[model samples]
Target: MYLYLQQQIQDVVKEFAKRQFDVDANVVVNQPPRAEMGDMALPLAMELARTLRRAPRQIAEEVAAELKKLEIVERVEIAGAGYVNLYFKRAAYATAFDQRTSGASTGKATGEKIIVEHTNINPNKAAHIGHLRNAALGDTFVRLLRSRGRNVEVQNYIDNTGVQVADVVAGFLNLEKKSAEEVRRLTEDPAVRFDYYCWDLYAKVSRFLAEQADGKAMRSTMLREIEAGGTEAARMAEIVSTAIVRAHLKTMHRLGVEYDLLPRESEILHLRFWDQAFALLKAKGAVYLETAGKNSGCWVMQYKGSETEDETAANEEDTKVIVRSNSTVTYVGKDMAYQLWKFGLLGKDFYYQPFHTYPDGHVVWMSSSERGKPSPAFGNGKIVYNVIDTRQSYLQDIVAAGLRALGYAAQADRSIHFSYEMVALSPRCCEEMGIELSPEEQKRPYIEVSGRKGLGVKADDLIDRLTEEALREVAARHPDKSQETKELIARQIAIGALRYFLLKYTCNAVIAFDFREALSFEGETGPYVQYAVVRARNIFRKLAEEGEGAKPVAISEATLAKFLAPPDGDAFWSLLYLISQRDAAAEQAVVTTEPAAVAKYAFQLAQAFNNFYHRFHILTEQNPERKAFLLWLVRKLEEQLTATLGILGIEAPKAM
Candidate 1:
């Protein structure tokens, strides 16, 4: 639809300009801020003015006259500063909006495989609000990709054997002095969530270790048992990791976050994937053992010399200890191995085992202990997008280096570090959570969230709070409803609010989360978006009962084409046509790699529906047929708006 319009305008401009320019000049087509401005306005004259050495107004007038002669243009006018405005035929828009016909904006352009890995939280504790942000954003990214017709395999990296897991093990065996059998019994209790219980215990253990002058000795012992990989500490860590990973999964599943695979850090080492990558680095002389320096006796990769302080701080040395003098792999070394595996360059592959599938589009799987049947090309994707935080920039930069150094520079370039800034708690929230900062530190712009210190909101706690609060509102607004229905509505509202707040900002902006702010349904938020859909749903329900007398109005089958009634120049049709462009917004997602584009589109659609609802009465119009048609338009707008919200991992409450 857009291409046809573009071609018509391009040909007209080409003929009118007298000088030849490319017919496809990337014309700027936008909806005029006001209905009077036009259905679609192309500031082509303004754009070409500088190039053509003519004022924008004269060029716009010439182009408008030329464009009026072609199809698709109901009328063409030159506006202020030579803007070429073209009003679309309402009939054309109505026919296009018909749910049966309009197609999505993109269709698997590359047809290349891709893997998106996110929410790889350490499986040793309860997930927190920070993790909620990551999952919501990552899941939305996957939906946008699939909506655009790309084959996306979503994975969740499980850091099962990290220091955090080791710490939890330390808390049980070393601190509590629990025996192996005793620990196993405590772990198996169904009444208690081992992950949530351990979350608090982990913090206690952290504080105890910090107060000791020789805490190093204890941590050293724990690290030894951890690296040994088969001792009780390691086994206990596995038990804890498994329980917590499940907890995280349940939380994500509640919010519609899904994943296709759970790739373990332990498997990277056991599969000897890194050994091959390590060999390649050595043989290529990409990294060398440092015999004498600050990081002496450690292997390193030198950074490219031309870097500023910010870049150099992370890149000054790809030179890091792959194996510490203590013979243990640093996080960087393990990540390099993982990165190599991602590109299928290490000549090692993982086994597939069925992990639990998610309710959304994810078919969760585990890397196998043995060879398993082939699944979708799980890796070696033409592109890899790791939705990680900016704190990992140092390590992520090295992943890029390792790819380039291993002669897979093409993959390295496609490999994206989709990094965002960290989330922090507001001072009031910090106070309420009983986590604090020193006055000296309070001089800063944001508070840092410290999970190890247990100094912020827990993910489950926030959800429970939001759900209860929402239930109260649900009861207030939706009295006489069954308890089950109220709970269902409450869950939908809570999830929508939480997900929208997490996604409202630019990815790189630090969110100083306030409980009051996140929980609010007012203003531009996820629930507000959902509430708009609910209003539209209510409008249609009222309309269906009144207009068709309890009979179905073929509303679901109603297309944008229905608005093409005689004298179809109404602003109502013009605004409803905006609802037909969900695919266009979905396309912007790939270009920006930010899910906020979807969020913005949802709000814009809501504003359109709201304006249409407030101005022209769908229920009280003079003619019954006209009123019914307007009601049909309302439902069409609702369908598309809700679909966009779904693309963002948001749910609409029918009653709000």
Candidate 2:
């Protein structure tokens, strides 16, 4: 409702500028510092003062007079040198709120498709906490886009032919002495989580390669065979990577994250995506073969910021190799091709096959070398957001530079790298999890998790732990509730705790994962907001038992205007204003690509609702009309808070 009023004011002010002053301008709307000042403020008069050679106060008075004609604007006052403060007509605002149901249509449909690629974990082992942060951030952003009426496709890239997967295959073959068939049987066992097995095996391979020089040769041989295909090593790679990919999907599903497609590096190899990308690069002079220096015989592109006094020195010092001396295409080269396909700039397409069917009836497809069945067309996004860690910022830049070098500068410009910092464990969290910390590590603020060292929490393990703790709380509070009911509530709270914890931090900030901080019932946690929802429901439940019906019916605008008039109702009015700004908060979150904005808004709304609850006794009010009005306000608050939680991918349970 606030967004609607803001747009109305902007249109009116923009037209007023063009007609009265003969000047074209952009009108920006902002909130006043205090609610008593005004609901919305426009400082356009000060902006036009110098251009029109007039005093700001005089221009503000003139604009304010014209703006008073708007139906939604109750009055416009000029204040403090040039500010135009606009107040909403109380009855009109109430009518607008009463007319629309919760979760009404948001922004207009944008025809362009947006592809967001995140959770691109290597298909080698179990996903860890770091991967959970990536998925939570990406999934929440997808929800925000859809809420704003965008056509979005979620893609999770798989690096099946990368060194990580090759290392696992080497461990199976050389270290464990397992044949291809034996590995396949192990993957087929329903009781065995193959990814968890590889999690430890991957770490062992890393240690072996570091301690023994001969182990390096085995890894290289396994990588070549996996990429070359038609070998036993390639079959083992397929079995392990395919099983691990399924495990990853299941892990993410527990958190309500889903994807439309999985584009694999193996498919990129079999489908010759790099061959076409390489041809384009060579023809456009985006990359060239180095004949001399340390990079001899390798195809390389000049680094983006490598300019120096001497051209030779610059190229020698900062060239990024696209193709190694052994003729293997680098990860960046393959990523360039993948990015090009996202925007429909690449002249090639991937054959796709259905990879898995989710419980919700959504079919997730995977890229294939040969067409298996009719599938929906993938890629061709007008804009793409790659949610990668900050460590890969340089490689991401190179991918975008490749697009610009090939003359698709417009697509390159639209390519966004939604980079974020890594997630680390808080020192307290390490102690609580029973992981011994070194004396030096204990003094640091946070400890980083490394999958290669087998020193990280598995995503599933953390979820299970949270669920168990939540169940204990629920059982204690609702002792008589059925076992199934308690379990369901526990799962909802656990998921809400995890998703909110991962999303509440800004993208550029490093989060130190701590269970106690996330699951706490008070102060900026998911359970706190969720408890607000449950409390509001209890009010309605009590009213229903007193014969007021199961839900509060809408009160007339005339009654609202009388009750919300002044002094005594000031707190109530303020709470209503906050509830009406949900759309504005969602728009801000979308524009910034930060879920933390919405999460913070949810916490604020929850805080406001709790304060209102304590100040008023709705059910005990003797005046029937005032009671109805308070009930109506509570219903609106509940609706808006629930919608906000939905956008953050958090569920509000019936009880805390």
Candidate 3:
């Protein structure tokens, strides 16, 4: 209802401004500082004064007079010479809020497809804490879009044939001297955790490459075999990558993250996506074959440092190798093709196959070279958001530039690089993980983890650690509950703690993971917000046991209006105002591409409810009308907080 009313006011103001000023004004609405002032404030008068050459005060009075005729507006006032403050009808607002709480849609549906590709972890190792941040951000953003009734497709790109996977394959064959059949047997062994085994092997191979003289040649050989396909080395790569992908999926599923598709680089290669993209790029003069300098024999593209560039510009450092002198396509080259495919510009598509299915029957499809069953149309996104970290900003820019070079200016404009800072481990978290830091590293605020060194905590391991920590608390609080029930609640709390901690920070801010800080029940943490909802449920449960009207009574708009009136109703109105802002908060988060906004809102809403819980003794209130209103307020708080938490990918547990 808050969002609905906001749109109504904006539309009304925009139409009025165009009619009176003959200008299409961009309506900017804001909230007044104090509740006594107004619900919303508009500075349209001041904005138009310069153009109309009229006094701001006169324009303000005119706009307020016109706004006063609207049915939704209780009163309009001019303040500070130009600001128009709008006070809404309390009864009407309460009525509309009730309808909205009953599951009425308040958003305009955008039927265009939105593709969000995230958590593109290399398939050679177990997912780490950094990958968790990517998945949580991407998943929460998808939820926010879905909350607004937008069409969203979640994709997780798999780099199965990349250098990383090749290094792991090199470890299996060169380091372990294992054949494809032996590696296949190892993957099938029940005693061996294939992903974890690969984790150690991947690090071992990385160190070998850095230390050994012939390591690079061996790795190059493995890469060529993997890329060429149809070899035993390629077969082992498939087995290892596929197994690790499953493990990655399982780890992410623990946090309620899932994907619609898993697009692989191998499929991108075998399906001739790069072949067609190369042809298009060559035809459009987007790339050129270099025949001189150090870049000789490579297909290079001009890179003008992310700024507008003259087409005829030339420089040595400003060139990026798309295809190497050795005739291997670079990662950015494959990504450019994938970007074209996403926008439906590449005249090619991958064969489809069901990759995995969740417990809820959600099928995650994967791209394949072999034809499989019919599946939903995957790409051709109207807009694309690549949720890569900030380190890949340059490559992401090249992708958008590739699109623009092919005359896809519109697609380039819509290609959003949802970049974020990396996650690091705090000193305390490092200690908890049994990771020893050097004296110099200990002095730092956070320790960065390197996958090649195997110094980072695995995603599953971190989740297990959090679950165990939460389980101790759950056991201490509810020892009488069955073990199954306690574990369920513990997992819920763990997921809540993990997700909220990841999301509470802004995208560009680096997060130093801490265990105790995230799982605490009292601060700005997930457990704090989850406990708020649990408190509300306990209130209703107590009311039920006491034989009072546990269910909320349908209060009339007149009664609600009285409760929302000033002087005596300020507190109730304040809580109602906070509850009404949930939709607005979700919309703001979506617009800004910031999940932290929603996370912050959940914490604020929880804090507000906790204050109201202490201020009003709902169970012991004497008056029936006031008690009923208080109960209704509690219900609204729970509804709003739960919805907000849902968007953050945090579940409100049944118990603290």
Candidate 4:
């Protein structure tokens, strides 16, 4: 609603500029600091004053006089420094609100496909808190894009053949002396969570590699065998990584994050994608063999930022090896291939097969070397967003540079590195989890989680803890509800708290995980906003029980006009104005690639509704007309709040 009004005002001003000044001007709208000033303020007069050779105030007065004739403008006023403040017709705004249909299309449809790749956790161990941040940010971004009517594909890339998996395979073979069949049996055991088993093994392997002289050699051999794909070690790696990947999917699904596809590095090798990409890079001179330097026999790409003469002369670590001396392609080389395929510039494609079907009937496909089933087309996106951690910004930049080197400048321009900082456990949280910390660590604000050391909070474990805490609170507050009902509400609250905690911080800010802060029903928590919805629902419920028929009848424009005529209506109108900016908030979030803005808006809207709820008493008012008006206000607030929460991927329970 606010967006529509702003556009209408801009259109009117454009016409006025053309007819009166014989000039074309772009009119930008902003809000005044105080509600009494106006709904929207335009400072176009200050911009036009120089052309007209008059005082800005004089130009503002003339524009205000002309704007008064607009049907949507209730009044126009000239403020200090030649600002034209616009007061919208309150009744007309109210009527527009009532007539607007839910789910009305917003944002122009560009018809371009966007691929968002996130949650690229190595398929070696159980997911941890750090992985949760990546998934939450990516999923919320997908929601934001969809809200703006964009076609988006969610991808979760799997590094199945990476060293992380090879280390686990080394632990199984060299340390435990387990064969392929034994590892397969372990994965199939119902009681044994294979991912958890590998998690412990991975940590032990890390320790052993540091302590033993032959550990590095063993790991290198295991990596080669895993990548080569015919040995018993390779078969064991597939068993471990494939099972861990499924476990990861389940963990992410608990937080309401799902992927449309899983593109594995194994398939990239089996399908010889790196071979094709290597040929392209060679043909385009994007990479060359470093024959004489310390990196002799390795194919390297000059670092993207070292193009300047001084930097190149400094010989700063500016060479990135694309293919090692032993002819093993590096992760960046495969990533370049995947990125090219994302934009349909590689002239190569993956054969995909159904991997899993989500509860919502969405089929997630996996890249395969051979076609196993008919599947919908994957990749070929016009734009790509890689949701990676801040630590990988260098590699991500190189991937884009690879595209530019190959002359896919447009795709390179559109590729976005949706990077975020790592998630660490608060000192208090670590203590509560019974993980002993050093005195120095305890003194710090946060301690980083390390999967290789088995020192991070497992995603499922954190979710379980949150749910248990929420269940205890729900049971105490609503004992009348059944155990099943309580559990369901607890799950929703837990998911909401977890997701909100991860998203409330900006992408660049590191999040310190704390249970006390996230689950608290007080400030800035998801439950606070959710409880506001419950409060609104209760108001209508009471009205219905009182036989007042809380169902708001269609209010006539004349009645709304009279209701909004006095000074008493200012508070209500202000709330309405804030509620109407949802579309604008969404657009800002998408443009900025920051989900924190939408999260902040949800909390503010909840605060406003709470303030209005306490200030206005609908059931106690004796006047029938005023009570009905208050009821209508409550309903409107409920609708907007519900929609806002939905965008944040939160569920508002009835008895919360």
Candidate 5:
């Protein structure tokens, strides 16, 4: 309705301005700062004042008169220096909301195949709170796209062959000096989280190599053995990386995040996916020998230019060294190859095998040669979204550049780098974690989280704390509730709190995680939103159990169609308005890809419902007609909130 009202006002403004200026008129509409100012306010008077040589207020008065002629305009007034305030019939909001919002923009994306690569953390350690930000944002992003009728292949890239994995191998082989079977037995212990064990082991090897003056050459030896495969290093890496990858999956499952595939780095290399891509780049002249420059020994590609125009904008360095004088490819080269395969430009494919079927009945495909059957088509998506952090912006840009260089412009244009800022600890949390800050670190707004140093909150630790706090609150509210019921409520609230927190910030903004702030149950938190929904549910429960107990209130598909169709004016129209927005939100999130906007809207909608609850009593209303309508409205709000929360990977708790 806001849009239609604005359109009507614009039409009137055009006629009024044409009479005054003898030319076409243009106007813009905006939301009023205060709802009371109007549902929407127009500030066209200032634009006319300059053109007509008249004061803005006088111009506003004339425009207001022109708009008042419409029966839809309940009131039109001039405010401030020149703004034209428009108030539609109160019922018009519900009416327009019902009709216009039924089909809000769900993005231009069709059911086209799209691949989203995210949460590609090395399977080296327990996922920390820092890792949750990446997974949470990526999962919510996928939810938004799928909500818009887009088919998404969510891949969790496993860096099982990276240097981080190698370090864990060094710890198990050279340091602990354990055999493959013995190491497997040690890792399988129930008391120790396999990921947590390797996390410390990786850090241990890293420290020993860097600080132990005698250990420098051992790192090279370990690397060589791992690269050769079939050695102790490779065997140990497989044990550590595979185990930790499963642990990370378990952690993510707790937060309602799951992957459609687990694409391992070793498979990419072993299956010659990179080799095929290298051949393609070479064949296309996208990469060539750098025989004359300082990069003489490298297989180099010319620096591909960016979109912006500026003569000096070309990277001064003529080439990116894909392979140094040595035969081994850099991480950049591996990534370039991966991108090619993902977009199907490399003409190579991974043999897919069923990795695991999740508890939720979702199947996760893994790249493997042990494929005993035919495959579900994967990769070569019309669009690709890689969820990574901003620190890797340069690398991501280079990947896009490589695509363009290789004549994959279409894919480059659509391959989005869904970058987010790192998670750091607030001073309070840092202190609580027993971390000491340097003067330089203290000067910044937050302390940098360090996985190498093991100085950030572990994901499980935060979940435990949140659950405990939630359980305490639940206990207070329902003293007679059984311990099992309390535990269940606590689990829901804890999951909601963490998922909402991970989502409530723009992807570009670094989070300064604070224990005290994250534990809050009141104001701008996930539990607060969950509580509102629970209260709404309780209201309905009360209605069902008591009062004139009118005919049982229920919603149906036919009713929902009418609920969102023309003459949609009602207290419930706004609730239905949000359903259409889920798609638009995903598209906006595609550009911003920030989960915070979705998270913020989820809470804002809940807030609106909560306030609506206070203004009216659904069961107590004497008029049967009004009471019936209110009950339907309440039912819709409850349904919408529950759906919105599901998109955010949050559950609406049955009780607060």
Candidate 6:
């Protein structure tokens, strides 16, 4: 309703401009500083002042006169140097909001498929806290798009044949002297967590590679065998990476994150995806052979760094090697092929097989080298969003540039890089976790975590810690509840705290994770918002037993309009206004590709509802008409806040 009214007013201004001034008016709508001022304020008159050489205040008066005629507009006033303020009709606005069939954007579908590829963890070790941030942001963005009625497919790309996986494979063979059968036995042991064991071994191997003489050669041989895919080293790589990928899925599932596809790097090699992409690049002259430079005998593509836009300034430093002299394709080369397949422009497709099935009956498919049972068609996306860390922005740019060089400029424009900063442990949090820090680290605001050094928190470990902390709180608050119920609620609260903590910051801002700040039930934390939902539900439960009956009071729109007028109505109207803007917030979040917008909206809605809960005593009020109005407010606020939380991928428990 808020978006519709804003558009209606903009249309009115455009029509008025074309008729009266014989010109077009590009209007921007904003909210006033205070609710008492107006709901929406537009500076159209000031914009027209410069174009028409007329006084802004004079133009404002004319526009106000015409805007007052709109049914949705209660009145229009000109304030402070020609600002056009619009006051919505209270009854009409309430009726429109109640009539809304869907909380998402005007109940319309874009008719285009959007693919979001995220959680591309290298299948070698356990997922760390840094990877958690990527998954949370990506999953929340998928929810936001789905809430806006978009057709979305979630993909978790698995680099099962990458250097990271090979490093761990070398650790198993050269360091442990373990055969493929022995590693498989270790993976199947009930007491052993294969991923956790590999995490420590990976760190040990990393240190050895720096200290020992033959470590680099060992890793190179292991990598070559894994890429070739027919040797014992390849079989061990398959076992280790597949087990680690399963561990990653379980970790993500605990946070309610699931994917529709798991595209693997091995399939890209076995099925010749790179071969098709290389042919296209060669046909278009997108790459050439380098002869006499540092990158001699390599196939290179021109890279125009952002430092300079002049194409004539190309030099040896401006070249990126796509294929080396040994006929091995680089990571960027395979990524270009994957990006093309996403848009269905590669003229090649992957054979998919079922990878895993969730309890809810959603089956995740993985790329295969051979045909399998029937499955739904994948790819052919109108837009593709790759959720990666900020450090990979240059590689993402090269991928988009590759598309553009091949004359797929439209697809290149639709390829979005959803990048974010790293996650670190707060100084206080490190102390809580019993991680001894150096004196220099203690003086800093945050401590950086490194997976290669085994200094990072595992995703599952963090979730378990949060759940334990929440369980203590839950036992204290609701001691009489059953153990199962308390445990379930504790898990929900833990996930809510963890996800909200990761999402509350903007993508570009670094997050320093702290336990106390996230679990607190005050301020802008997730528990605080969750408690508001509990409070609202408690009101309705009591009303069913004490008020008129279990059924809601059938109040007229006229009565709602009365409470929205004069001295007392502004408070109720303000709350209602914000509630109606939930869909608009979702649309805005999608446009900016920022999940923080929706997270912030959910927090604000919670705050407003809590204020309303304190200001009005609904059950004890004697006047039936006013009591019915207050009850209606409580219902609307709870519904909207709960819906907003769902979009953030946070669930409100039955009780806090």
Clashes of each: 10, 0, 0, 0, 4, 0
Task: Give per-residue CA lDDT, model 1, range 165-247, as digits (tens).
Answer: 87878888868998666767877888887777888888988988888887767776777677667888877877778778888
lDDT of 2 by residue, 348-415 (tens): 89998999999999999999999777888899998899999999999998998999989999999889
Superposition error at 27 for model 3 (Å) = 3.0
TM-score of each: 0.89, 0.95, 0.95, 0.94, 0.85, 0.96
Q: How far in Å is the alpha carbon of 107 misplaced in model 6?
A: 9.3
What is the C-alpha lDDT profile of model 6 across 380-408, one tens digit per residue?
99999999999899999999999999999
Residue 211, candidate 5: how far off, in angstroms? 2.1
Q: List clashing residue pairs in candidate 6.
A: none
What ranges in model 4 sit over 4 Å off? 11-27, 47-54, 103-110, 305-316, 434-443, 543-552
Residue 69, model 1: Cα distance from true site in angstroms: 5.5
* C-alpha-based local distance difference test score of model 1: 0.77
Question: Better model by TM-score, 4 or 6?
Answer: 6
Q: State the RMSD for candidate 2.
A: 2.1
> Which lDDT value does model 3 have at 61?
88
Q: What is the lDDT of residue 574 in candidate 4?
A: 89
**For each candidate, what is the lDDT?**
0.77, 0.89, 0.89, 0.88, 0.77, 0.88
Candidate 1 ranges with C-alpha deviation above 4 Å: 1-19, 22-26, 55-66, 99-110, 212-221, 306-318, 359-362, 371-377, 441-443, 543-570
How well is each residue in 578-616 modelled by candidate 4, as lDDT tens digits?
A: 888887788888889899998998899999999998898
